[model samples]
Target: MTVENALAGLAEQGWVAEAEADEAVSRRVGRPARRFRFRAEAGCMLGFDIGLHKVLAIVADLRGQVLGTRRTAVTPALPAEERLAAARRLGHCTLRSAGLTAQDVRGVGVGTTGVVAADGTVTRSDLLPDWTGTDLVTAFTEPFDAPVMAGNDARLAALAEHWRGAAAGTEDVLYIHVGRRISSGLLIGGKVHTGRHGAAGELGVLPSSRWDTAPGRLLAHWADPQTLFAAAGAGEAKALAALEDFADDLAQGVAAMTLTLDPELVAVGGGLSRAGRLITDPLSRRLAELCLFPVPVAASQLGDEAVALGGIRLALNAVERELFDVNG
Candidate 1:
């Protein structure tokens, strides 16, 4: 096609706009090469995470810079519809804070605590009451006015770590998200691995695995892990012992994944990752003892925003594929 036809096509598709020709550029490239530039202000993306304790919404530009975020508490007893409504409110609030509307959103990405199917349905969930089998895509469509994509919260957090956080450069990684519940996400050959049944990294489901019980038992007496870690740091005997037991339990699951995948790095993320060295130091030591070889482990720098950021990445990819004809 001729340059005129090409420019016209791009303009028709709302991808490019004519800009004022600069004198210097016009002199060098002959008439400024028509001065067409990509329309970057076209739209943005919306990313939200619906967790057991809270719902967080983030608005990011196409380039993935977080513009704004809004969070709302989520009680376990709240109905699924109410929880979804809360998510919607937070999403709109984030968009408003970012000085944008739903119409400016290219796509919406949602991460929820559950086994998510490819079509954005929650296959199962126990973290939040009445959350199983939710058609999340449909639920968010009206509120966001865009195509919606959804994934498991832990898995999405792993994706965020891989994309721009802890596991950024690694081709193979094991991400363990430790919070009120224990779950994991796997990245193999630089891609998120969800397994045949979409249940990869669900180590907590194993009856013999301490991943299911250790954290809860530890928290039953202490207000939170941070308190226990503080006590352990201060040389308290009971706290030290409790931390050791928790580390040992966590290490068992890490060792199993290490032996199976031999990932380049193991990333620990989620709400509990904020404990920093308090958790990583002992967990690394125990992991080294359990593994045949020492595996490098790091805490997620993204903290609680990991899943929401991952949702942003997902939304970006979806927008690119649908609007830009680019494949991720």
Candidate 2:
């Protein structure tokens, strides 16, 4: 059956349609269906991450318990379609290793880095240069006949940190995903607040004095902010200066966000975040200097897996139609 039919089968099997927990509840209801008699059955959700070097897929049950996971390196020289086809096969193998089949998968969620359009198009991925404008929804949904969901990896990492990891129990939170580039995600009132155009968290585009506009691309790379921090950790004085300046700039960005949204906490993640005090300590002090509210900053609990886990969380909640609005 196709994904639409699978969802219909779910309803036909007596599963109640619940509002997305991430969205506000409505008093309005759809036409009630005649109660069908069917016992509850165990099912699974698959969370997949397509990255520059490797593809990671995680499998979990309705309750969010992880069952199995698989990862494989990719040959970057290949075309986008070939890479996607490889991902599909890897996903199938991942499920097979978990003793399940594609039909048994209720939903699949993907988290990829870079600009994700509203209609499920992944534009400008740093890892997979060829994947720009790739329609991931069609790629997974057509063949597997299962509902597929996709989002920015950093955004979902922020969601996962809020829901099941470090930022758990917070109502308003911020997560800065630091890597080759820096991006951020926000959870306000416990829901991921992606702005209009689906580009709110693209911090790399945020202006910074450290960047050079002459070459154009130089400005983009310098504005990332994380590069400075990484440089500092690598023992470069010039880079450290850039990082300190970037920290001040980051304070400005964080301050603006705090003034507007007033998040209760902020957490840092990604490969660069592992540097710890080289980044967080200065960041905390700067945030204090810039903001009126005194919210604490911490590191991500799940590290690199945060985004993948967030994908799993997204799928599980969607399949079970459970409340997913809150951070914890």
Candidate 3:
């Protein structure tokens, strides 16, 4: 088709609009090309992170430019219905803040703490009360009138890291989410490696694994991992000891994964990753000791937005495939 025909087709599809030319061009092009541009009001997408203690909603454009975000605190003790309602509220609020509405949303992506199946069902959720077996796709679809995709938060964080953060340009990665829980997300040959049962990264499930108990024990004395790191940064003996123990246990899990996959890079993410040198310095040293070869480790630069940004990436993928005929 000619350029005119292409422009006509795009105009008919509401993707572009013709505007009067502000200036005339030289005669390299016939009659100076008519000015046409993408529509000003292009559709956007929503990315939501429903965590154990908070719900974060992000609104972004097709190009993944985040316009606005809203976060609301939530407790696992709340009823499932209440938690869902809170998520919805935050989602709408984020869209409103972005000057968009649910009708303008082309797709929705959700990241949650659980084992998410390919169909967006929560196979299991130990962090949230009564969240297991929830169909997240349907939950968002009805309210947003958009296609929905859901995945494990840790796994989605890995996706974000690969797309625009710490793991960018790498094909294989081992993403360890160290916070109140221990989990991982693997990327093999540039694709997410969700195990057969969608629980590939539940490292804490290993029988008698120190990952299962170490974080809890440390948090028992400190309010959170950050506080513990603060104490350690101040050279408090107990806090330093706890961090050393935690690093050793974390390295054991990392080594197990390294032996199996031999990933190109290891990215440490999640809330605890904010500790920066406090955690990375020790964890890197431990990984070097455990692995036969040195493995590069870095803290997630995306911070708390990693999972939500990953959700945005997922939403963009779905919308592009369905509406733009492009592979994600």
lDDT agreement of model 3 with the native: 0.85
Lowest lDDT sum, 10 consecutive residues, model 3, at 23-32
Distance (Å) between predicted and true CA of 264, model 1? 1.0
| TM-score, candidate number 1 | 0.91
Root mean square deviation (Cα) for candidate 3: 2.6
State which candidate, 2 or 3, has the greater TM-score. Answer: 3
How does model 1 fare in lDDT? 0.86
Clashes of each: 0, 1, 0
- Model 2 worst lDDT window (10 residues): 209-218
Error of 1 at 87 (Å): 0.8
Instruction: Give the Cα lDDT of each candidate.
Output: 0.86, 0.72, 0.85
**Candidate closer to the true structure by TM-score (higher is better), 1 or 2:** 1
Question: For model 1, what is the alpha-carbon lDDT of residue 244?
Answer: 70
Q: TM per model?
A: 0.91, 0.73, 0.90
* Candidate 3 per-residue lDDT over residues 1-328, each given as its tens digit: 4778867987997778888776554456455666887763678889898988899999988778889989999887987778888999899999999888899988899999989999999999877749998889988998999899999998899999999999999999999998888888998887778898788878878856678776777678887776787888899999888877778878888888887888889999987787777777888898888888888888998988999999999888776666557354
1-328, model 1: which lDDT tens digit per residue? 4778878987997767998877664276354456688776677888899987889999988788889988989888889999998999898889999899988988899999878888898988967648998999999998778899899988889889999999998999999998878899999998789877678988888867789887787677898777877887898999877777777888888899999999999999977777777778889898788888888889998989999999999888887776557355
lDDT of 2 at 211: 17
Residue 200, candidate 2: C-alpha displacement in angstroms: 1.4
Error of 3 at 143 (Å): 0.8
